[model samples]
Target: MKEYYPPPTPHEHDIEKMSNRITNARIEELEKLKERKDELKEKIKEKKDKMKEIRDAMERGDTADMILSSSAAALNKRGKETSNLTNEDLLEIQEMAIERLEEQFSKVEEELKQLKDMESS
Candidate 1:
């Protein structure tokens, strides 16, 4: 085995190596998260299609970018209240639909939670 020694002062390369390792790890986690989000979006699409098909089978119908602007308009402190919402929020988000909305809401909420955790860490 080869023994490694630190220089009198560890060089930029060592610091860079550590930073690079952390960055690579974060990127890998982000990639996995993106992949998961994609999968969930696909599943959501499939469910929405199924909902449409159900409606179509019943009534014969078929069918749909978005941004918020202005920093001046803001409200509420963001601790647990804003960024982290509750089960009631989940319920309200799904209040309009039958079972499908609830299912999708749960999935979406879970995904949001995971992303939030990643961001926090």
Candidate 2:
């Protein structure tokens, strides 16, 4: 004879539904975090590329004598010589800024790892 089983109680069904919702929410959160991490990586790469361009320009001595009007080149003096700041000094400042961006990228990487661990558990 087959064994008889009772259907799940109302409370058990509610609990199961809630658990599924929580799992879905966690998955969504993880996806968003991963996306953010990717964006940060891209930003860092772009910054590095820009830094290289700045270095090349500095070496040519062209960028030092004039400033580009674009917001990105806003720091340039537009042919007005800064008494105290050299191209080398400006390059150093750019390096410092890149270092800060790298720090932020590292933090995002760490956060993504933590979220992955949580998802796995």
Candidate 3:
């Protein structure tokens, strides 16, 4: 005598397709998140370089050219505003950029965790 097995449920294929679709979407989202993280890193590097240039100009006492290039002030008033970026202001700006980078890293980590969870499920 031959054994008999019941046919699979009609919704099984649909469920499988849905699961695959969700997985693919999560993968795409993860890729996008990684790209965004890279972009943020590049931005951080640019900001650091800018801060370094400003610091170096200040140290050399040759900030006139740097300030003039960076500001839109009238030639007469240029000396008053742009060169007034104290060390404190530079430090504050750098700190803010660092904080923003940290926040972006945290968000990327969280998204990675979620993607891993979805993959496991």
Candidate 4:
């Protein structure tokens, strides 16, 4: 019996190289996901600040931008929150909210999940 380290073929080396490339790509994909989640978190904070501005405008009887800005801010905030939701969390939130009982809790739970996932990941 021969103790063997067979000479690597071109095909074999290509396969190993392709595997490494795939692993690198997967890592980049995960990094992009992490970056997107972080961006959404910052967006949520921006939406909160924008909402405060809109509320102040409304209180001061400045309806010119209040209607548009307030609605837009709400939409932005909702989008930011939803982007951070996992598939399961989203399904649960949708179910709870649609039920219309303690509906606000659904939103709170979703936001909490987003925050927790963001932190842990």
What ordering of candidates by TM-score runs from best to worst?
A: 2, 3, 4, 1
Tens digits of per-residue lDDT for model 3 on 1-121?
9899877677987898998998788889989988987888888788788777767777877544454464636643655544565555765777798788878878887887888887787
Ranking of all predicted structures according to lDDT, beginning with the best and ending with the worst:
3, 2, 4, 1
TM-score, cand. 1? 0.42
Worst 10 residues of 4 by lDDT: 81-90
Best by lDDT: 3
Candidate of highest TM-score: 2
Model 4 ranges with Cα > 4 A deviation: 60-62, 65-121
Which residues of candidate 1, in runs, are more than 4 Å off? 1-8, 11-13, 60-121
Summarize candidate 4's per-residue lDDT along 22-118 as a digit string, tens digits: 7687666666656655655555555555556545655676553234555556767788421343334433543444344234435545655665575
Please give, for residues 67-96, the per-residue lDDT of candidate 1 as tens digits. Answer: 111111232322222234333343343343
TM, every model: 0.42, 0.73, 0.71, 0.45
Poorest 10 consecutive residues by lDDT, candidate 2? 64-73
Which residues of candidate 2, in runs, are more than 4 Å off? Answer: 65-86
Candidate 2 residue 17 C-alpha distance from true site, Å: 1.4
Q: Which lDDT values do the candidates have, in the order given?
A: 0.52, 0.72, 0.74, 0.57
Q: State the RMSD for candidate 1.
A: 16.6
